[model samples]
Target: MPESTRERGRVEASRGGSVRLEDVAVRFRTKKKDVTALRDVSLDVAEGEFVAIVGPSGCGKSTLLKLVAGLLKPSSGAVRLRGEPVTGPRHDIGYVFQRAALLEWRSARRNILLQAEMRRMPADRARARTAELIAMTGLTGFEDAYPHELSGGMQQRVALCRALLHEPPVLLMDEPFGALDALTREQLNVELNRIWRETRTTVLLVTHSIAEAAYLADRIVVMTDRPGTVAEVIDVGLPDERDYAVTMARPEFARATARIRDLLGAASAAD
Candidate 1:
């Protein structure tokens, strides 16, 4: 299958360095039958762009993110990162799951430093990075708190800080805020926008929320139902300078959100 115009643009923006998946398909073979989760999925993400993937339940959105994270391989086709085929999990990428997944025994600061320690970053530098991230995520005073002591939003913030501690060029988030209450989700959305702008890290977020996708993405990629494929890629017309008060009320924001919601509905009906 040929790459779409937006996918082509993403490839080009990588300046001869891109992440490409050619005719990617995933299938699980059981004793009785085969289950296909993704089919003919081809996408290219550029060097520094925030792309959100949205689809109905069981539409392979999470599977797609895992493929890029190198946690799962397509039964057919290839996955690559920055011109290199991703044969396994790459250090240049950081992944955040729906849950904060913090170790109960560790303090928030120690949790953030875990990944850095695994990568064998110098102790002094790791400590410095941990402190910086804590401050960045507004977790400064909570550094000594354990997972049980923090609220849902705070734990996720620690996870975000941990993901960025090593300064990975790409960050993959799978519905990281899905479990949060509405108010916390909105607050995190604002904080995430600020963090993304400050770090300039390319991000790919998978979410089921049309509002969340519209609110957080530079471009939203709507996917078809199970045996998922790209349905549409819509650019968010809202200004980069976004605030909850100003941007959410803008006509452009509503239009973008409606467009994506409609696309997702159509995709679901087609399933």
Candidate 2:
């Protein structure tokens, strides 16, 4: 997530984020048999809450996001946004993946406006928003720079801005920063926290980093190895605004990370 921008001349406006999953499951049909990816998973993310989901590899962490994004349907139960069922793909939700996925020909500004163009957002408004998002993500001067001209982190920043263009209530990120170098990943984490705070976007981020989950989320949901189910949900219990250095130095941060590590280790051993 990148920081949100004000309406250029007017006051800052915030958006609501809300997501709910009820007894959801997903099974894939293969020639051999059915393979269940998720089983009996239920969760709720209140408006403006930041939730992080973590689990071992192939635990269906990303699958949960897909269900909410309407990219996949559950074998049972339901997924909802604003209380309405997500029966199909809809534009009200935003999604960002591990890779930047920018079209090489498109400049940073053009890439940010791609979503708006597809959604048929007003021309004047879209241009203004593109400018604002670029500035928000600290891409002010690189607006005209093509994807090939940007670094890995900057490209990902553009992707994030693209996802937020329409102010989607539920913003889903699947290990969006996983591919970057350690320094860049941590830097984006700081930016994301600031961005999320300003926009108040309801975020459901799936990651493998326990510390990252603790650093960014209000709650961390740890899942079993496979056929994922919620093993534990731990509140981060950190301050509203966090500084990585200060937050990590706190005894509570150590306790929280250790607790999640123990849970994940237990889950791994069980598998």
| Cα lDDT of model 1 by residue, 1-271, tens digit | 2333443233445533345677899998899998899998877776667788998888898998888888898899988887888888788888899999999999999999999889999999999888888888899899999999999999999999999999998899999999999999999999998998888788899997888888888778888887788787787766655888788888878988898878877776765
Q: Where is model 2 more than 4 Å wrong at Cα?
A: 1-17
Residue-by-residue lDDT tens digits, candidate 2, 160-196: 9999999887799999999999898899899999998
At residue 247, give the lDDT of candidate 1: 83
Q: How high is each candidate's TM-score?
A: 0.93, 0.92
Write down the lDDT of every candidate, Cα atoms only: 0.84, 0.86
RMSD (CA, Å), candidate 2 to true, equals: 5.8
